[model samples]
Target: MSDKFPDQARVVIIGGGAIGCATAYHLAKHGCKDVIIVERNKLTSGSTWHAAGAYAQFRTDPNAGRMMAYGGELYAQLEAETGQATGWNQTGGMRVACTPERRREYERAITIARSFGVEMALISPQEAGEIVPIMTTD
Candidate 1:
């Protein structure tokens, strides 16, 4: 919880996103103390903090998928170790697109999610509303 930066570090991570924080955690856990995270913007300013605060184990690469999966698996231990709330949950996610190109992107996303063993489907905007009441197809 120290906001003051150190003079130097052996490893410098560019972002304070989940992945960067996790890397710092493991590195510190393994007895590496000279690690620093440099976030150009404020902490949690990236997709990891925004984007509905969703956690996904699905990724285009198998290794990436496994790493995401590992993050969930490690969450309990992380919270226990740091005595902090991870804010982790299983609420799932939703994406809405008004343009044809955006819809096509979602279509492609579905395929990628499926390939990564994620259970997702293309649902109507009303159906999406069932998941996130504030969401709209319009």
Candidate 2:
């Protein structure tokens, strides 16, 4: 290995997961050229590899939902910018309820999503199964 390191950098990131990479990308986008990302493993080899990649942003807290939504949008744009696929899918999502209390929870989540214009829907068990074919009503 070469015993040499870059002479200078404005920012040094310690991970190569999605968050770290995204931060690096944003920093670079804002004209911060001296950014270095140090990874113990290859890019996306950490927790990001195991991520379910779900983009559901149904939250009672509007700011939290907005942040998640922004992350999703940034992920979508990242692929195009880097010429690498981030495996983003917009198939939509559903939260099922197996009991009355759980149903109320789903209702509240749907309301929150709607308030943020997040484009979600409340559906029956059958509809949920249709969206996620592997799901079981039981």
Candidate 3:
């Protein structure tokens, strides 16, 4: 980045966190110029810095799930498009449900996720434990 800020900008974003940076990136990706991002601190130094950097492609609402699915796809291709590493990994995620009610809820989410082409599944506690050996199934 240059030290000199432009006198005028077509769009000025308020933060330098993930959302703000993503908005600017997408805008520029779509051929929009003259964009500026103003940050109170260093980039990702606020809430975004504390984030777990995990994304789930399933939600109670199918629309929200679809957006998450979009994010997963975008992260997968961001490095290739920008020639910059986003540190995104495609490791599969798991949600453990020790109770029957939570299990039902996840089943519902799986249905919603799958409805919009997001692949999610419910596995036995044993299966989940197998993936993470230190986790207890019982």
Candidate 4:
């Protein structure tokens, strides 16, 4: 960290949030030098600092789902690639549908996810209960 800011930079990014920092990282990774990030305050001191470390990969749009999948894959390998410990655990999650309409929506989502190679399935209430024994299916 340098107290003196550069007089000139080829690229100047506003904000120091996740997206901004990610953009800067990718730009530098692709050999973009003289990139400067202008933050209002310290990095990630805004909403990003209080963000819940959770992400949903299932999406109705195939392209969005694929992008989400790519982010998941990137997070899984981030620690190894950057030598920085990112506590990302890939524990498979479940979506509980309380109504027939929700179930149908889940089914449609499953189809879309499968089409883009995202593993998803709609399980029966009994099956779901078995997976989480403490959960009351009724």
Off by over 4 Å in 3: none
Instruction: Supply candidate 4's per-residue lDDT for 15.
Output: 93
Q: lDDT per residue, candidate 2, 34-73, as tens digits?
A: 8888899889788988875755677767788788778767
Q: What C-alpha root-mean-square deviation, in Å, does candidate 4 show against the real structure?
A: 1.9
lDDT of 2: 0.78
- Model 4 TM: 0.85
lDDT of each: 0.74, 0.78, 0.87, 0.87
**Cα deviation in Å at residue 43, candidate 4?**
2.9
Alpha carbon lDDT of residue 133, candidate 3?
96
Give the per-residue lDDT digits (tens) of candidate 3, residues 1-138.
Answer: 789978889999999998999899899989997899999999888988887786677689877888888888999999998899889998877877778898899989988888887878888778878889999888
The number of residue pairs in model 1 that clash at the backbone is: 0
Better of 3 and 4 by TM-score: 3
Instruction: Please give, for residues 85-138, the per-residue lDDT of candidate 4 as tens digits.
Output: 988988878999898898888899999888877789888889999999999998
Worst 10 contiguous positions by lDDT, candidate 3 = 54-63
TM-score of each: 0.58, 0.78, 0.90, 0.85
Give per-residue lDDT, candidate 1, residue 29: 87
Off by more than 4 A, model 1: 1-4, 59-61, 92-138
